[model samples]
Target: MGSLGSRVLRRKAGLPRGEAAAAGKGGKRKRGGAEGTGDSDSDGEAEREERLLHLRGRRKKLKSTSKYIYQTLFLNGENSDIKICALGEEWNLHKIYLCQSGYFSSMFSGSWKESSMNVIELEIPDQNIDVEALQVAFGSLYRDDVLINPSRVVALLAAACMLQLDGLIQQCGETMKETITAQTVCAYYNSAGTYGLDSVKKKCLEWLLNNLMTHQSVGLFKELSINLMKQLISSSNLFVLQVEMDVYTALKKWMFLQLVPSWNGSFKQVLTEADAWFAERRREFGGDISFLESAQGSAFLPVFAHLRLQYIISDLASARIVERDALLPSEWLSSVYKQQWFAMLRAEQDNDTGPQEINKEELEGNSMRCGRKLAKDGDYCWRWTGFNFGLDLLVTYTNRYIIFKRNTLNQPCSGSVSLQPRRSIAFRLRLASFDCSGKMICSRTTGYQILTLEKDQEQIVMNLDSRLLTFPLYICCNFLYTSPEKRADSEAQLDHLES
Candidate 1:
């Protein structure tokens, strides 16, 4: 028997032991000395070498194209010091590419990198952009300084605005304006408004109105265009109307005459004519008459008056944003009309007992005292006139209790609501709250303080959150809450009532 290890020797992996073993799996065997075996092995090795060479060539091309970015963004040679800037950074080409590709995010966010990155670097990141390929695609259209086409400048400026690059956006806007006409300005009026470009809106409105004035009228039928006219009127204030007086007057006259026998427009025209009649009446009365006051004789007047007052107050508020600077400072005097109304109502209602007067003089004195107290409380003192929900109610109900007490720890005021009583007066006062929603809700108290005036009425109703109550408070407080000066004046005026 061959050795039990014969199979093991047959499986040996190195060079063949004899000539018969040199032939592949099943070929005929050639028996010779070691020279024949050597020649056969050399042929096999040569073929293997050729295969590996082909694989290496393929791998080299794949690695070059797939792993490396081919796109290059060249910056100005003069601005080499600046390199690239994107999203508030300076970056090199490779880093920019990495950023564009998203590979640099971990690196960028890992620690603060001071490198300046360009817009392209910020935008494309790691994506390969072969310059040669881009140049071919662009042909003669490519410019050295700008990466985008001339036609896309507006879009680029818009992108700049989205990125919050104020300078770039403005520059683009100016450039477009320089190259275009009033037509472009008119086209973008709404866009300008959306952007809150007050200047742009002003200019666009001027252009549109000027053109309309030259035509003396749009000549559009009232039935077809009443809505458009209403929208235009609503978009602006008296100043805009005055500027486009010709247009406004024509529209107003046409609107006013719609109720006359010859009128033949849509329901909208009929409505405008009716509105003009009432507007003229309102103008003569200095404003709309209260439905309740007018209704003293008419059964419908009370409900109509209250509803009209609410509507007027709401309209006044909506008009504030557009009329901020247009109206005179003295017009602010009318702001407290509501507060005065409530105060007079309260004073008359409770006339049977308690210190009889809580009016302008007493309110002024108390406000001055409070101002002194506030001045002592912090480094800054703010006094405002107009309306404050809390202050107005405080002065109206418990006018005697309002006083100034300086809290001397020198700590800043927390500006929260408090009910502090001194002598016979109970002061339920709230410092302004920073929370916008919380600020809207005024407060009231029922329990008691040292000073109590009991009148046997139905009830001391204090639903401050009710719609009727809230709107009045809003009307009283909206302008007054603007500044400490206004609040101080209002307080002083109310304090005078006490004296």
Candidate 2:
């Protein structure tokens, strides 16, 4: 009886009517044969089968009920039971259709003053909502599906969220996620956060992390907010070009743009202008106050705090730039210099043999960030700069094969090379190719692995399929080239107190 009731309920919902029950009844009778409920069981079975086939074929030919309702009831506003007034626009809507939205459902079903009113004024506090968005939101109540444009999604999302339309909000979120690009990512991220769409926000952040260094632009730098910039700069996942020095350079450029919002200059000219501007500022203040100490630059201190100054000061040229700009306070540079000095002593004297196990926290905070861009399909060999605790690692891309070599000898290199028989390094490698809009088209990653190598030995780290290979590919790497050193008593005490 309960099963039969459920079948009846389904039928009322516009599902296939009694077909399953009729087919089951015919099958049971056929199986019983002599003891069948009816003698024409076989004939009934044949009739039911024919009817089911006819119904299945007619489904494609039938006009969608939602479409009919949307066209006549929504588009034409025929037989509207209610008029919703807001944003200087009036929508002639029906109570039944409006009930699909939770906001309206509660108003009509609950004891609300506006429930009995034929004409209600909607108080829309969100500025993102507009008349067009409201029209789409209301129309969605009369339809089963909505086609959302990426450009219009935020406004529609705002309207849908206000009316508590879950389905429309979800569709808008999906559209935003799918359409994210360099131009739209910041706007989408802000909208997603505003609408409490965490997934879309995450997608935007991932896009930013991947392209922040690899596919940089003046427009993108201008669009990036301080909060977003801090998140990207702090994470080890940042795809830094060349080395951490480039990240610093990018930050310098971004800071300059943030300060001089009206400065319209070429990408090549940004660093020069930034350098000149800061130098001028230093001269203006007679080098008495650091840029970060100044009122205007203090707002940016939080964002700059995330940069791995240890890496920046490790390189002579980058350290010189930091010193020349005086954007950061002397204490910041002194502290980093002291920290790096101690680290160098530990790496040089303590015989740091790279990381043995993957400590995610350590990698996230201290891993060396670097990347390379491949323009064509050919043999390429390159190395990133750092003391690297004598770990002279060379990267090679040849014939769709990527190989990593620990160059102790055989290859003339610039920096110190470790002669250890075997040393381990915790590392992550990511490769991606982007489209013109800076949306990642294809990508691959070797997620956090500890690779041990012998002097002058190589390992085939990754193999690429020629079919999946896209030109202008960006390869990013995070490496922990030295094992953690034991904390001194004073440092441990200081850390404990801070915690």
Candidate 3:
């Protein structure tokens, strides 16, 4: 039977019977289970390849469909469901894409009258919101990348906020943060405040506080609104090495800039020129300075109310106030003097105790007894006095040591001052006097002690033999509290010094 089957198979293959029989025997030997398994594995691999190709084709088709829809609706505006008019320009946009925002969704999807309208008019009142910003905001709805710069960011943010586009608002904030600098921070901060961007507002304010002197040097303070100025000056967190007088000086400069329309260039030059003009006019007018006084008084009324007058420790700064007749009215200055006298009496009564807290109402009432403007306990306090005569003092009490720092800037006189911590939580001071041009003439470190807390009250008497003093003499002081452990350390250091 095997022979017969071989003959039939050979005939079917159309080969010589002997050759076909030999081939069949060889094939049968090779196909012993393993050959069958090899054929089955190849078939499975082919099937998987075919399935993968099918999936790839489907994905391509889906991607092509999405691309076509975006191109037609957003780019070409070919089946746009709505038109938007902004700043005298028209934009054809799709309702579906616009509906992604709650603002637009509510406008177009509900039974409101706008839903039936084909064109929507955006009537945002901000003059800063222009056509370019609107284009960027509208493009952002369909695309991921939008160009933003300092000049356009304010407008873009305003538009985005009006549209209620959270994504775009966040993007604007991030861009502002990246681009913020001393020169541009004021504008950005104002824009953020206008649009209610709290995060951006906080960041800009912190930067301003940290780099206040830098900003002042660049005349950025001239751009600040009264409210913004008040906010900054009144913040307890503002850290500056400058005396409160420097702050007052900066404020005066800002006010001067606002008053004088043609003023330009260096503040010193403008001030010098103005002083000459004032001097010439004073002579011509027989020293009647009432007009100049009235102008300054009106301009400074809003600003002066925010000044922490008690913090001005420099006699030079205070004298400047009287000489120039600047912010502090005579009545106000008199009240301040009276307050100082009372404080001195109180300190004597308390036997020179630690920091004393005065009642705000009582102080205000006493200072301005009749129709007096009330003062709030803001950043202005006796604890921190502005630097005077190129000298500033800082006293910090921690668990460790009572630290004292005396800083001198641009001092014409040259001398070293030694500070020794005493057992009474005070520092015994020694000061040397130098003549103008940095020449040391006299030294006096003995017979003087300053309580770290009330050091602002103690006057440094210069008994220098030099016939001339270049800078007006003033001393400023500040006291800071620290942790309990630091306080203990401070006490121990005091005891060691006494021992």
Candidate 4:
């Protein structure tokens, strides 16, 4: 068989028998099988090895070429296709790589005016987009390895957003998540909101909800803008240990900081600064006082507009507010009281018989006791004197009944309150019963009611219901106001009444 195979191989090779045998012996031994089968297998294996080696060489060359291209376009800027001017610095960039961004794609492709230019001048109108951020953003397109830290992530995010780079935006968001803490989150949230980075904004807000009451959170609150503050305070997701009063106090601290210029000290310092500024202005204006009052009132109106006064639990927390009169304007305090009163009245009207009607003369005497006071001692006269919607009234409430007396005080009304005259203020009240575990057992809310006093009425009194006397019961008040246009009209009427 071997001889026949050798002869057949010799014939195919067209070689003499002896010469063919010599060549076969030499090649066959190297190939490692009998009858030359090994020669074909070895040749195939050699071809595969050569192909693999060539492929590896080509890959290395391609990688080197890519590196060279990046260097030429970025580091050297030799033959760069575009010029990006950000924050007064010029960056020479390649249009091909930059075109990966929607911003660059739109500018360089299609019928846009910049498409035809070899040297495109790119300018992001925002001053926050700095050159270093641009460098990081541009570098990331060509390389897989990019570094993002807390310090540079904000600027990079801003630049990436402006450039419409979704991938880089996502990367920045991930970096922000890794870096977020109570101290740094607010700054990141502000940046995200400013740049419209919704993903990062959401994460920051969620983080805030969890960490809002921490000692570190005060730093964040100090830096929050009025609009942001309002957004946070009004958000349903915000969780606080003491929902009503702690939030109110934090809001007050924020507002005081906003009102006082260059204020770095405590809330007391803020009040002092405000007082000094007002006094200085009054003296400067020859004690005219009107302009200063108006300016200060306007400043505070926006701040107070965001405060949810009705949510404040009216027991001990509100009592503290009464003691620290400087924390809120008297008129704001009054609005809070009125809201609570209206809520109580609503609860009573819904859960029990409608308000116990009393003759106007019954409450005529100054400081007349209304319903029987609760057994608990101590002054429970919940008094607040702030404008609510279009009504400017001094409100006082006790365990038995609530009193609303139209405030005739000469203090100028701040625009923060609704100016429209409301025919009546509507509100709801809930009496919550809690168990020993501090969980609510049952809650009863009153049907909505509109409390309207007669034109000649000095005070309107509504009696507390007997059903609300259960131990561990909480009276929750919610106030509803008229629409803005209606509020303006009501405010005008109240202004006339005051005059």
* Clashes within 3 Å, all models in order: 51, 1, 13, 16
The model with the greatest lDDT is: 2
Stronger candidate by TM-score (1 vs 4): 4
Per-residue lDDT of model 4, residues 1-499, tens digit only: 9989979986566444455445455565566655555666666576566556656766776687678866776778887767777666777888888988998898777898878876656667776778899888987777655778778888888889888988888888888866777567778888878877788888777666444543333355567676666666555434443344556556555555566546666544544555555456446656333331455545545545555555453445566653343434556667667756654443334232112332222112111111121234222433232324344444444555556544333344442322222234444444444443233355455544556543323453455665655554444443433321235865797899999
| Per-residue lDDT over 1-499 for candidate 3, one digit per residue giving the tens place of the 0 to 100 score | 9978978886565444445444554455446435554465555565566556656756776676666765776678887888998778888998888987778988987889999889988786878888888887877787656668767889898888878899889989998877777567888898988888889888888666544543453257567777777776665434333555556666666666666646667755655554555455456645454323565446556566655564452244555654563345556666756644544443344343422342333232221100011122112112233322122443332221224444333222232212222112222222222233222344333232333422232333223333432222212222211101234865797799999
Query: Which is superior by lDDT, 1 or 4?
Result: 4
Give the runs in model 4 whose Cα sits over 4 Å from its true position. Answer: 1-73, 78-92, 111-116, 215-219, 265-294, 302-313, 323-499
List the RMSD of every prediction in angstroms: 25.2, 7.4, 17.6, 16.8
Candidate 1's C-alpha runs over 4 A off are 1-154, 179-182, 196-198, 215-499
Q: How many clashing residue pairs, candidate 2?
A: 1
Measured against the true structure, the TM-scores of the candidates, in listed sequence, are 0.22, 0.84, 0.58, 0.51
Clash count for candidate 4 is: 16
Where is model 2 poorest over a 10-residue stretch in terms of lDDT? 57-66
For candidate 1, which ten residues in a row score worst on lDDT? 474-483
Candidate 3 Cα lDDT to native: 0.54
Over 4 Å off, model 2 = 1-61, 64-67, 489-499
